[model samples]
Target: MANRLTPQQQEFYRENGYLVVEGVLSREEALAYRDEMHALAERLRAQRTVNATWPSIRAKNPNVHIDHCHDVQFHSAMVSRLIVDERFTGLAEGILGPNVQLHHTKMFIKPPAKGAPFPMHQDYPYFPHEKHTMMAAIFYFDDCPIEKGCFRVIPGSHKLGPLEHQSPADHYLPEDKYRLEDALPLPGKAGDVIFFNYLTIHGSGQNESSEARTTLLVQMRDPTDCPTVQTHESRGQGMMLAGIDPNARIRPVWEKE
Candidate 1:
């Protein structure tokens, strides 16, 4: 992958806590992933699977739909391939390091109109590590305009090292809690990828578009560091996508991934 960041680009990420790499995937490739996910989502719907919801992020209403497929790498082969793809690995190495392991993959499909916004929060709080090497790579499968609730991030917030986020109790800080005069809106097209720091303060607005805003989030971390508390069944783990796990141990859930 010739997509390695230049010194300036790397420095920008270091100083801003977030960077967007345009055209990380081709339009056809992004469409392919979207097709697979839509099919999977239908299957889940047929099985009567309920998606995880935000109980209090909404400013207007409650019980809005915010669809998600957790640990998608375990359920979909195409997603697993994307998680270990050399392009994403390069982005991770550019920021975190050369040696990184896949923590998990999640698919966020925010539907039109009724989709709720995610409250302002740092990703590090949910999955804190000993060294805070965790990073997130989000690939947009659909065009993300402001109408679709594009990601809004605070520059250099990662350096703040996790602020007091107590909005919904043990979750996120409400968007209204901060002034956000400096928040940067990152509107993306299909195939764009955003790599961000785990401690970065970020969130999205309500989806006002007619189409769903789809994104695939791959969380990667340095293997030497483990999560302070495992939130999901295998939140801290899965099959290592890059380098060897320095703190490898026998766990039954790991083999399942």
Candidate 2:
């Protein structure tokens, strides 16, 4: 039960808006999650419920594909346990303090050759919170190199707060201003995780490698922080990951009996 992140790491995160921690999960653990993800994808595919491409990406290039599933814990028990695991939650606590709550979880599988690329943008447009405490931890299930479309970010971008996105419905920064080429690529090996604030401007390139890049992204926030907009609500949204929810309150009932 030691501190998962050091003072230096915390400082880097606060200053640069992101931090990459290696060996968060062991090799064996990462492999297990990767296998489970593929299995789940197969199951969802059979049911014709798996949409392997995003609409925006498709509009740009029909060949490119990036398979994804939201609320992944609801589909896999292993993932459900992973969200609350102290090793992971410890990182959340380090950033958001003791009382951490789950915002949502998502799994992304960037296929080889034709993986979709995400344009640089802030997560605030999707789900804006009052305290700006919302952050994400992306768990790499396999080695992710620059060629594999590894995550990229603009250091200190979070300090700029929420910038104007291109479209309210479809979130992205203007390509002319925030070019992907200008961002720093953060290549990571299996078991590594990258944590960044919601206001940080980030994106990734297409996976042109032979292998797929699989990752699980978990969004967390301080329980006391309230959302500015009621959006992106998930079945497991309010679940506490670490410590107690200080903002919890009993709901009032209307006497109709």
Candidate 3:
């Protein structure tokens, strides 16, 4: 927690819209996180069929799956500790100012030879903040090379504002239609962390490697932010991660019968 990004690193994030840091965690810890996440994924996936409820599943192809868990932090204590750990919150604080709040926690499991491609998209469209302080931290629990479909991003795209996007609705924007001719791949070993802006244009290729890629994505924001739309109820709202929320106050809600 004491270790934070250097001034140069912060500048790099501001300029490039992303930063890949190595040794943020140990191999054992990363694998532990992966094991815990995969266990939950399998259990949840078995109970529901992407049909009867809120927990949704997005497919990359016939064999590939993009597993998403909205309230993943509460499922396991290990993951809960990792997300709020100062090692993560410190880095997020570097880019997002002093105060930061956790927006959502999700784990991505791309099985070998079947991982899907995430079309280029900006995350800001989903749960936007007026201050534009939202960002994400991708924690790698395994070695992810280009063959495993590592993250691809257009550097400095955060400053470009919202661009024209197509479906799967708000979250998945087509990369082919954007200025991604010079996009770069971010490959990392276990324990590495990649931080990027919410507005960054990013996507991933299909996994052609033999090993599955397991990663945890943690979304955060400054606490002063409010939802632009009703995409989310106050499910995990006002949960402070780092520093203090000056606007922390009680709000009333009416009972529905």
Candidate 4:
């Protein structure tokens, strides 16, 4: 099982801090996942009575957002089984090495019209991690176009280290002398997957299409960091991965003798 990355991809990741591994999934597979997502959304919708417009809705039923993510990791218990499949887990083993933990999973659903752009920041900043102790696998469940809020990343920016991000305007720390004029839009059809280092500075644009731009973001971390448990509802509640609770605390469930 050769997990060896192409020379170009290796260099791109090492130098720029990101690698866009394209076409990892087929259109059929993407559609299957998309359909599964819709079904889950229906289930969540049926489980509640509050309308989508009600502010109390999210406060009362946080699971609704998680269910509709289409990212798979947020709600489906099936993600653990799917990622363990050779197509994904093998790549993880190859890129991240043997010891790894599924740190977190999220879905970015940019619906038709202009959704808020994801603030530009490194993934590590949002959680407690020791430096660059993680890698991210961003999978596309639908064709991603610039108009539909595709991912935009600054190549070679990872080498610069974590930046100081600002509010109001989500710009980087120690603001780069050069603006993001050269940032690249990772374009791909449904099923494509992009592997990038956790330190990579990335964000998406406003959705400007009739359809949604949906993607799943799975982050794998070195077991040492022990990914912090996130209580924030929007941060997503995680499920068990490979018989282990990736976000588990030191103690076991309170039922112990």
Worst 10 residues of 1 by lDDT: 248-257
lDDT of 2 by residue, 1-257 (tens): 53378889989999999999999899899989999998888887787755456456677898887778889999999999988889888987888998888888999999899888888999998989889999999999999999999999999999999899886556889889999999999999899989999999999999999998999999998888888766777777888888987755552111113
RMSD of each: 2.8, 2.8, 3.5, 6.4
Output the lDDT of residue 88, model 1.
Answer: 71
The Cα error of candidate 4 at residue 119, in Å, is 2.6
**On residues 1-257, what C-alpha lDDT tens digit does candidate 1 reach at each position?**
63577788899999988899999899999988888888878877887755555666543577567778888876788987887788777777777666777777888888899777776788876777778878888999988998888888988989989777775343676556653334678999999999898998888777888999888988877777666765544653656776666665676333444
TM-score of each: 0.90, 0.94, 0.88, 0.73
Clashing pairs in 1: none
Which candidate has the highest lDDT of all?
Answer: 2
**lDDT to native, each model:** 0.78, 0.87, 0.76, 0.60
Q: How far off is residue 242 in model 2, in Å?
A: 0.5
By lDDT: ranked, best first: 2, 1, 3, 4
Model 4, 224: alpha-carbon shift in Å? 2.9
**Candidate 2 global TM-score:** 0.94
The pairs that clash in candidate 4 are 16-156, 164-173
What is the Cα-based TM-score of model 3?
Answer: 0.88
lDDT of 3: 0.76
